[model samples]
Target: MVRVLFAGTPEAAVPSLRKLAHDTEHFDVVAVLTRPDAPAGRGRKLMPSPVKQAALELGLPVMECDPSEETFLAALKATGAEAGAVVAYGRLLKEPVLDALPLGWYNLHFSLLPQWRGAAPVQRAIWAGESLTGASVFRIIKGMDEGPVLAQSTVEIGAHENAGELLERLAQDGANLLAASLQGMAEGQIQPVEQPQGAYEVAAKITHDDARMHFNVPAFALDRQIRACTPNPGAWCQLHEAADALEPIQLHVAKAVVAGADDESAPHGLKPGELKVTKHHVWVGTATDALELLVVKAQGKKQMGAAEWARGAHLTEGAFCD
Candidate 1:
C-alpha cells in the first residue's frame, strides 16, 4: 500500500480525507495535518478543525500546526509517509516539507484550474454569472494553484443556485476525483497536464463590503450578487423612511429575481433603489430593470416574505432603498 499523508482543515476536505483513510487496497493514510484549533461559536470556545475531528473519529494520528514552522516540518517527516494529499489546507507549504515526500503532493481544488484560482472560487463564479464550474486534482507546486492537473470533472450551475448549495455539490464531486487520481497514479496510468498560457480571473477572499447590494447595476447582476452572498454575509440594503422618528432599517435580501419591464405594476423611470410595494411583491428599481424580492430579513427580525416585511414597515409606492 502507498503510505500517504493527508493535509486539510475545513468541512469541504473531510470527505476526501475519509476516502483515503478507509481505502486500504491502494492507500494507507498514515497521518493528518491541519491548522491549530481556534475559538468558535457564541462562547468563543477553542474548537478543533473539521479535518482533525474526522481523523480522530477514524483513529488516525493528527498534527495541528502552521505548515511553515520547523517543528511542523520535523513532525511531518516522522510520519514515514511517501506521498501527501491536500484539500483546502488553507496554508502554503514550504520547500522542506514539500521535499520530504517522495511522490510529492496533490491538491484537490474546486475549480477548473487556470481559472478562478484563489480562495473564493465558487462564490466568484456565481457572482460573475458563469454557467459552468468544476473540480480538479493537480500536483502541488511552489506557485499558488498553478499546477499540472491529473483529473477533472465539470458541473452546471443552476440559474438560481446560491454559493452554499453549489459548494456542497462540488465538495462531494472533488472527493471522488481525488480518489480516482490517486488510484491512477498508483497504477502508473495518470499523467499531469500543464495549464495553457492565457489570461485567467482571480477569486480573492470575500469581505463585508462585497455583501452590500449595489442597485446601480442591472437586475440580473443584482440577482447574481444576492445569490453569491446568501447564507453568509448576506446581500443587504438600507430602507430610508421620510419620517425622522423612524430609523433607516437594514434588510437582508434572501431571494430575488429580475422583473419584466412591461409589467403594468412596475413603474418606469424610477431612480435606482426606489421601491414599489404591492399586495404580492416588493419591486426595487435598478439601472436596466426592476428586481422582485421574494424573501427578505429585516434587521433584528426573523426571515419572512418581502411582501410581509413591506406591510409591516408601512412601505408605499414612493419609498426608497439605499
Candidate 2:
C-alpha cells in the first residue's frame, strides 16, 4: 500500500481525502495537510478548513502549514509519507519538500492539461463559454500546473450551468479519477505525458471588478458573465436614476436569460442598460437583445425575485443599469 500524504483545504477536496483513506487495499493516508484556520462567516471567527474538519472525523493526523516553511519538510518526513496527493491546497510545493516524497507528488487540477491551468479554472472555463472541460492528475512541478499529465477525465458543460454548479459536479467526479490514477500508478499501469507547448490561456482568479456586468456587451456575453460569478463575488451592476440625487445603487444579479420572441416579454425595444420592471418580470436591455432577470439582490438586502425587489425600489422609467 502507498503511504500517502494528502493536502487540501476546501469542501471540494473532501471526497479525494475520503477516497484515499477508505481504500485500505491500495493506500494508507498517513496525514492530511491544509492551510491554517481562516476568518469566516458573519461574525468573522477563525474556523478550521473543511479538509481539516474532515480529517479529524476520519481519525487521521492533520498538519496546518505552508510548503515554504523551513520546518514543513521535517514535519512531513516525520509522518513517514512516501508520496503526496494534492488538490486545491492553495500553494506551490518546491525543492526539499518535493524531493522528500520518494514516490513524487501528484496534483489534481480542475482543467484539462495545458488549458485553464491556474487558480480559477472552472470559473474561467465557463466564462469563456467552453463547451467541454475536464480534470487532470499531474506531477507537481516548479511552475504553476505546468506538469506532465498522469490521468484525465472529460465532462460536457451545460449551456446555463454556473461555475458553482459545474465545480460541484467536477469535485465528485474528480475524486474517483484521482483514486484510480494513484492505484494505476502503483501497479505500473499509468505513465505521465508532457503537456503540449502553445499559447493557451491561463485561469487567473476572478476579482470583484472582473465580476461587474457591463450592459454594453451582448446579452449572451452578459449571461455568461453572470453565471460565471454566481455564488461567489457574485455578478453585479449599478442602478442609475436621473432624479435619485445619490450614488448609483449596487444590484447583485443571480439569474438571467437572453430575451427572445418566445420569452414572456417580447421585443422590449429598450435602449442598452435601460431597465424595465413590470408586475412579474424585470428586463434589462443589452447590445443585441434584452435580458430577463429571474433573481437579484439589492445591497444590504436578501436575494429575491427581481420583480419583487423592483416593486419596492419604485424605479423610474429613466432608471438604467451600468
Candidate 3:
C-alpha cells in the first residue's frame, strides 16, 4: 500500500477524503492536512474544516496548520509519506515540505491548467462562458499552476449552470479522476506534460467586489458574472430605493437571461446602468442588451423569485443602479 498524505480544506474536498478512507486497499493515508479551525457564523463559534471532520470520522490522524509554519513542515515529514495529494488545499506548500515526499506532490486542480490557473478557476471558467472545463492531476511546481500535467478530465458546462452546482459536480468528478491518476502512477505509466508558455490568465479569487454587477459592461459579461458567483457573494446591484441614509438596496440576483425584446416597460433611451423594476421583474439595461432577473434576494431577506420579491418590494421604476 502507498503511504499518501492528503491535504485539502472545504466541503469540496470532503468527497475525495471519503473516497480515500473507504477505498483503503489502494492507499494508506497516513495523515490528513487542513487549515486550522476558525470562527464561523452567528455566534462566531469555532468550526472544523470539512476535511478535518471527514478525517476524524475515518479515525485518521489530521494536522491543522497555517501551512506557512515550520511546525507544519515537520508534521508533514513525520508522516513518512511516499506521496502527497492535494485538492483545494487553499495554501501553497514550502520547498522543504515538498522534498520530504518521495515522488513529489500532486494537485487536483479544478481547471485545465494553462487556462484558469489561479484561486477561482471553476468560477472564472463558468463566468467567462466556457463550454468546457475539467480537472487536472499535475505535479506541483514552484510557480502558480505552472506544473506539468499528469492527467486531466473534461466536463461540459451548461448554459445555465451556477457556480455552486458546478462545484458540487466537479468535487465528485475530481475524486474519480484523482483515483485513476494514482493507479496509473503506481503502474509507472504517469507522464508529465509541460504547460504551454505565456498562454494563461490568472483567475483572481472571487470577492464581494467581484460579485457586484456593473451593467455598464456588455449584458453577456454581466450575465456570466451573475452565474459565476451565485449562491455565495451573489452578483448584486441596488434596487429602486432605500429608507435609511439612502442605504443601497442590495439585490442578489440568482437567475438571469439576456433579452432584446422591447416591451412597454423596457427602458430604451436610458443607456446602460439604468434599472426597470415592476411588480414581477427587475431588468437592467446593458451595453448590448438588457438582463432580465428571474430570481433575486433583497437585502435582509430569503432568496425568492424576482416576481415574488417585486410584488411586495414596490420597487420604483427608473431607479438607476449606482
- Tell me, by TM-score, which candidate is best: 2
Residues 251-273, candidate 3, lDDT per residue (tens digit)? 88899988766555555655686
Per-residue CA lDDT of model 2 for 191-238, tens digit only, reads: 889999998899999999999988888899999999899888799999
lDDT per residue for candidate 1 within 1-322, as digits (tens), equals: 7898999998989999988888888899999989999899869999999999999999999987788776877788799998899999999987788888888899998888989999988889999999999999998888888889999999999999998889889989898899889888867899889988788999887787888887898889999999888877789988774424267788899999887757777667767888878888888889988899999999889999999988888865457887
Candidates arranged by lDDT, highest first: 2, 1, 3
Which of the predicted structures, 2 or 3, would earn the higher lDDT when compared with the native? 2
For model 3, the local distance difference test gives 0.83
Give the number of the best model, judged by lDDT.
2
lDDT of each: 0.88, 0.90, 0.83
The C-alpha TM-scores of every prediction are 0.91, 0.97, 0.91
Clash number for candidate 1: 0
Off by over 4 Å in 1: 241-247, 260-270, 316-318
Q: Which candidate, 1 or 3, would have the higher lDDT against the true structure?
A: 1
* Deviation (Å) of 95 in candidate 3: 0.6
Per-residue lDDT, model 2, residue 10, is: 93
Error of 2 at 184 (Å): 0.8
Name the runs in model 2 displaced over 4 angstroms. Answer: 241-243
